[model samples]
Target: MSDDGRQPDDPLSRFLHGETGALVFVREVLTSVLAVALVGLLLFAVSGVWPPMVAVESGSMEPHMERGDLVFITEPDRFTPEFAHGDTGIVTYETGAAEAYTTFGEPGSVIVYHPPGSGGSPIIHRARFHVQEGENWVDRANPDYLPATSCEGVPACPAPYDGFITKGDANAEYDQVSGIAPVVKSEWVHGVARVRVPYLGYVRLVFSEAVLVQIDGGADGVVPAVGGERVSVTGSERTTTTGVVGSASPTLATGSAHGTPTATA
Candidate 1:
């Protein structure tokens, strides 16, 4: 009998008291690992996607979804109202075309996507509207909205494809000028965020810089900014802006000189 009035062969009691050897400790660790892996595999099977969870690294989706918020994403087709062009979903604007506006119903659903050809990290933002190939997007919500001067000769509003034009709710520009290439239907759109587990994602974001750079870009990498994502103004060159609001002055609503100059919108 043991001091606690338990039998020596009480395996369950030994585990309860954590009175075990290295072998037992190793067994416990392995059990935990396996248990977690099993749960993950189950979620993957149920969701029909490999990566069903994503960490928010930028403030782009701010006020609505903050930095470090752990977001649960599901395959787009798994849910209703698959992303489509025009008259549905959130309304997006051209890179330099939109200055101010409000989206419906809790700033719209946040989407995590791989912008085609950018080779950056997954982006978390909202789909304002989708542009059909060879279509032009204008801002009725923006009073002083002006298309980027560089977009003058461009054949399309976002890009030369049919896909959703996404943006941060608090941002003045679209993803294109903000540094993300363009989201395409057949190529780049990944998944949409359905659920959010707040603040826990910071554990990863705190350690994920190289990962962050890959997610956004080395320059456009999302660093937590004023309860929002990184801010930039694109003109002849792109101006990368960091820091929280009120700490740093807002970038010009029009343009600046920081990243490579490209045709706008």
Candidate 2:
């Protein structure tokens, strides 16, 4: 027996000998397993590949999608000139891939490709205009007889033109003169703006727009100028906007932007 009347070889003592170390080991393992499961679940839920996206920088999509809203995307397979009017899907400019929009770069011009009887693109006004359907024309550099303004993989240009229009929702005026190219190929479309999580986008806007760094350590620090994922919009509309094709996920509609709610297909 030990000094305290407990045997050194007691089963209870042995169990308690390295309890802290054991706890740490168990904690680390559990954490790793959880992380793996989470990643796998996300991958499975969002289809095979993970998408790249960020929060809305402005309120161009206001009354529908607000500033600081979180947007998820999925690329389209083919670029068609027509979209149903009054429809709010993710559209891109002729400039570059989807990632380019959020990055620092000069805005390029692109045409607003309107299919016959279809309404124009949605409200994001920051988009640049590339080419107009009949206003601009292009001839391929090779004997392929393709038009410069026509999208790829479609029939010869000007005959069966399959180009796309692009624009920014917040802009006051439409682009008409830049002569930017159209997104004729489906590969050019990085993804569709599938869903918008309100208020969640604000965090991304603050970080990407440098709103926090400007106010850090300042007298206004306590004023709650907006930082991190906690700031909420005053009098903001709380209702969710459902997609046109089908109903949006209930969790996305009701949950807060900062909440780690999963989206169901």
* lDDT tens per residue, model 2, 1-265: 5899755876556554434667567667766767755753563356221222323333323344445555443333223223311122333443334335431122222111112221111112223323334433334212232323343433323323434433333222221112112333323332344445666544433322213322233222211112111111111122123111111111121111111111100
Candidate 1, residues 1-265: lDDT per residue as tens digits? 6799866766665664555687578778878867756765665565454444555555556566555555554556665342323323333433212434333234344555544344324455666556666665554223222335444533245357777766666565655544444544635444445665566444444333312332232344332221123212112122232211111111111111000000011
Top candidate on lDDT is: 1
Best by TM-score: 1
What lDDT score belongs to each candidate, Candidate 1 first?
0.42, 0.30
Query: Over 4 Å off in model 2, which ranges?
Result: 1-33, 36-49, 77-162, 175-185, 206-265
Worst 10 residues of 2 by lDDT: 256-265
Task: Count clashes in each candidate, considering only residues at least 3 apart in sequence or on different chains.
Answer: 13, 27
What is the C-alpha local distance difference test score of candidate 2?
A: 0.30
